[model samples]
Target chain A: MVERWPIVGMGAICSLGSTARETFDALCAGRSGLAPIRGFTTDWYTSDSLFEIDDRDDSKDRPGRATGFLLSVIAEALTDAGLSDDLGDVPVLVGTGLRELRSVELWRGSGAAVTPAELHFGAAVRSRFGAWDTHTFSNACSASLYALSLATDLLSAGEADTVVVAGTDSITESMFGVADRVQSIPPDAVRPFDRERRGTILGEGAAAVVLRREPGTGGSPRGWVRGVEVNCDAHHPTAPEAGSIAGAMRAAHQRAGVTPADIDLVMLHGTGTIANDLGEALAMREVYGEDLARPVCTAMKSMTGHTSGASGLHSLITALQSMDAGRVVPVPTLEKPIDEMSGFRLAREQAVPVDARLAQINAFGFGGINAVTVVEGNR
Target chain B: MSEQLFVTGIGVALPGADHRDAVLDPQVPEPVDPAARIGRKGLRYKDRATQLALVAAYEALRDAGLLSDPDDAKSHVAVDASSVAVIAASNYGNLDSVAATIDTIQQDRSTRLVSPINTPNLSSNVIASEAAIRYGLRGPNLTVCNGSTGGLDALRWAGSLLRAGRAEHVLVVAVEPDNDVVRSFAGTPRALDGAVAMVLGPARDEVDTKRPPQAVLSATQRAATIDDLLPRLGVDLTAVDGWYGPGGAAEHGLIGQVRPIELGHDWGTPSSVLGLLQCVHAAARFAAGATGTLLAVCGDPADGVYCGTLVEAPRQASRALTAAGHDAHR
Candidate 1:
């Protein structure tokens, strides 16, 4: 057997809560982070509703909202991993889908407090995590999922023994403009799997995790990242492909050396948009086939909203928390599940307890990027 | 463990009004001609960076015998691009479109004026995925935004794909388009418009295979200092036939005291790819003999993290991929 890459520590700062525990607890209780947009003001329609982090601190040292959020999670993740102040050889991989636009916004006055003329999203993370080296992935929303996979490859390929995979993005005016032009943002509550769901509610958050090659005994790990698979549909830059999405999911399970039957939980990349919900649900049914012994499925975007690059990591950590609690957190506002998702055992308000050993999280992005990662429970 | 990447094909497009393959000074700003691949008609509305990447990708694919000439039946390889993965490296993406979209937003105070096509180019992954969409590559399409060291980073990720058996060949391409917006705000004075493409495949051990390989590449290795990297590649620091570098980067400590020689032309914006392209061009430099070894090293000025690749031309001795260490770190 090869070296096991167990996630020794996890930290997250999203609209739901400031820490992993708070977010997990809130999500399990069916709480939502969606609210009126804060911080940066925009002239677009998205100003009415966004899952923006509450910017309580006006510190001059904070580079940008996203960078500040990223540092907080990385610090907590390092501390949680027991490495604390000793990050000697560990490489840092960051996936920020909107880093370019975010950097531009930072220069445009919102981040005037940020010092140093040239502030980089990934480089800022390097100093915070004490990483000797870093890698940046900007594959739109599927970025951090690719980062996690790259980290696993780094570990398995013997590049490094441990790695910190983290990602962060902030709702910016430019992105809001893009969304406004496309008219992809919902006017009401962000709802996934709901027949009346309009579109995605853009969100911002940061998540960090330290992965070790061997199972850690010093602290409680969220889960073990078994395998990650990524591919492109080559169909449309914006549209999701059902066949390719199913192919990515099956590939992940196959690489993890497991069958669909072995998966206990499936966290979807449900963006609440009509197209995404339908496409992802159809892909799920294709992967699991017609077997009634299907895995429990849920989508966290109903609460967290679409976290962009951080969505996949958030889903993985959320699944691990539910697995630790021996339950599955229901997808909030999932009334009137889509036709394609009706065949699966979709989670609703109540927490359904199950002996979930393996959990799979799927993330799809623009540019036809599709990523699926399988993680094993700490148990 | 990492495996060696056999270099089967290489293509490069240099900046200037003409967009030549070999440019003495590529610092001039000019978009590459889409030429016959997409033709002028297809790329009329496409951004400069996308057009450059498309052209380079087509050239590399053709050089690797993955694409057949419509007129020549004997040149037909009939290779399926769906099985080939793509890894693209870039620092700024299409800043031109990003600037236009942002400018339109400020000018009109509404996004309605921005073209739908220009908005998506803000994401750098569009540069990589656009090529995948055009070529029908179903494998992993990765985009790295690590500035100067991006080309090496893409090669490292490509090596990992080979080791994992995820793909048989990966088209590693890097393109930097002239963005007046970037020049005005971002202080990259040396930035130029250019695109480089290379095809990496599973390291071949057969010397007399059906196709003669351009070069055999060792797994890309990362080093804080040149001393650490040379030992891993099992080569003495000064033993290589030549070294290719961009400007004074080779002398910059991480690569040790090697002369900062510009092998052919190092005027490209993404200097790392320029260095790799220079190394590939050095294959023809050794006219006295058909055999030589060259080491290409590049360092990101932001951080001194160094990544180097050892290229053996018309080979002789070789070391296993696992023995030669490599890292795709930022």
Candidate 2:
């Protein structure tokens, strides 16, 4: 028998807004968060623009040089879920492919003493809440999505009544340096699924979702996390293998007792890279079949860019808000509705009305680590 | 709601030797010192990762009674490939490589050589790949990288796979080799080099089913933070044990009567293998009803903590007879 899982609370901070409500409003109005990069010294770096978070007031109050934009996004998620005041010492799982690479660079460049990213993150969370068991995972880009999978397992095993799952990564000069070295960072704005798409524009943000056995005392919940699956390609650390990516998605769908056809929408990892988008499209086609009119798919990364480790959770928040609002958020810019090379359907323009009860989110990171999470509406 | 998890096999490679009897006997082998020629003789040919895993996998397979049919390694999946994750807490990644790499760069930028020893040995995943190739394992492979929590996290991951029916026999290995970075950073507390391998499967034997069972693992753990759990378990971070230098830090008293062997006692450095050694020792003692209860608490000092307890049970004596039944099938 399937267990009845309930959504207690949710939170997020993305390019569109600092608060969950604000982000949801933007999503409803089909607002975009992408713009020219101005947060850091980009001339000395690689990419010219990114999904930087600097509008928020507290974003300026960050103590260190490499501001963990994701932490603020997590704070927003906690507040939205009514968990800001009362976290109640629950276990916290945070995933990031890059654990404060920016901070590490700042320390390296300035020669200033800095706290290790892992300890600093834990200390900050514990101070906000009480002492809680914490785990930080860095599995390339699949980090945060893998965190979600771990949280689900913990909750299913009854290890915790409530588990807070968060994924955050900041865009810094060092991130660009690495991306530039690898030739993965884009030259301009993101264009996922487009024929002219080049590469992923690095983005920064954080997201946290409070998962509990029952609805929290705080009132109504948005949606509950259902099934999540993770797998390593072990094929190539940098490039993803289509077979394994498809296997991961299938594993999650099977575990959830759902099918590819049952999915209402798909939140593509859509890193804006030609290889990544092509790999995802091939995987989706293999899993979902040749039916042209299948699940409505959209790439949120076009607006938010790739939020590094936080991209999974960042897109999840946007997808969840859409589920809550009963609409599908449109793409930031889809110049062409049907790219000749694209095999799946893509959504464009303002928010569209759709009945996608079940959806999937893909987060594939460096090292060929792939994590797929299947989210469903109340059946 | 309780699921039955069984200890079908175990592997261990320690300072003393790579045999189950040698590892569990508590009789220190003649060449116990790390610096002695006898110990250093093999250090040149084998990478520290290979030595640690080979010894641990041998002991585990012996304890599991899979030595006769080494190719019949179908029952277990390795949870981590990290040296620390697979072997011991102290012998994490090699520190000498880090020191040398940094030293070379500092001394002469263009003259430094980036050796293979400096590359693969520094990362923990090499051990997993090596073990897989050595044992011919093709099942689900994962390397838990949650710092100190790697050991327990590996166990948890194995448990999930077994419960989910993903694998019939899951081999959970935690190995750590001696490293230089850890030594300079914190003086290598109870650090030692060793590997602990366990075969996790469905509880079958009478001892596993009995109350106060041998190695009773509560999948549904109590929700407690790392800070609170450590204090409750009485884990003394200050007064170390097993290691030679100063000899202050100690494992939780819950793991009663381990008869720890201070490997390389003269060097004032204890082998990081003590934790795995102690775990195997306590589990064996508990199974034999020599101890009332024993607990192996694994966690990352920075984050997650997992606690596992083993209780005394006399019914496990029948395991020898059951071993024959499985042997006949092969």
Candidate number with greatest DockQ? 1
- Contacts from the true interface found in each model, as a fraction, amount to 0.48, 0.05
Let me know the DockQ for model 2: 0.12
The residue pairs that clash in candidate 1, if any, are A134-B330, B220-B326
Quote model 1's TM-score for chain B: 0.82
Chain A only TM-scores, each candidate in turn = 0.92, 0.89
Q: What is the lDDT of residue A279 in candidate 1?
A: 87
**How much is the lDDT of residue A271 in candidate 2?**
82
Say what the interface RMSD of candidate 2 is: 8.3
lDDT of each: 0.72, 0.55
Q: Best-fitting candidate, measured by TM-score?
A: 1
DockQ of each: 0.44, 0.12
Report the Cα RMSD per candidate: 3.8, 8.4
- Candidate 2 structure quality by residue, lDDT tens digits, A1-379: 5443555556666677777677768766766677766654444434456677666354221334223554565566566666655454576777765554444334334444444324225545655565345555544466677778767776676656777888776664434444543453445667787776777777776777777766777766767566877665545424567887888888888777888778777888988787787777778777887653577788888777777777888777777767766788777666753343365668877777887677888988654567888876643
Docking class of 2: incorrect
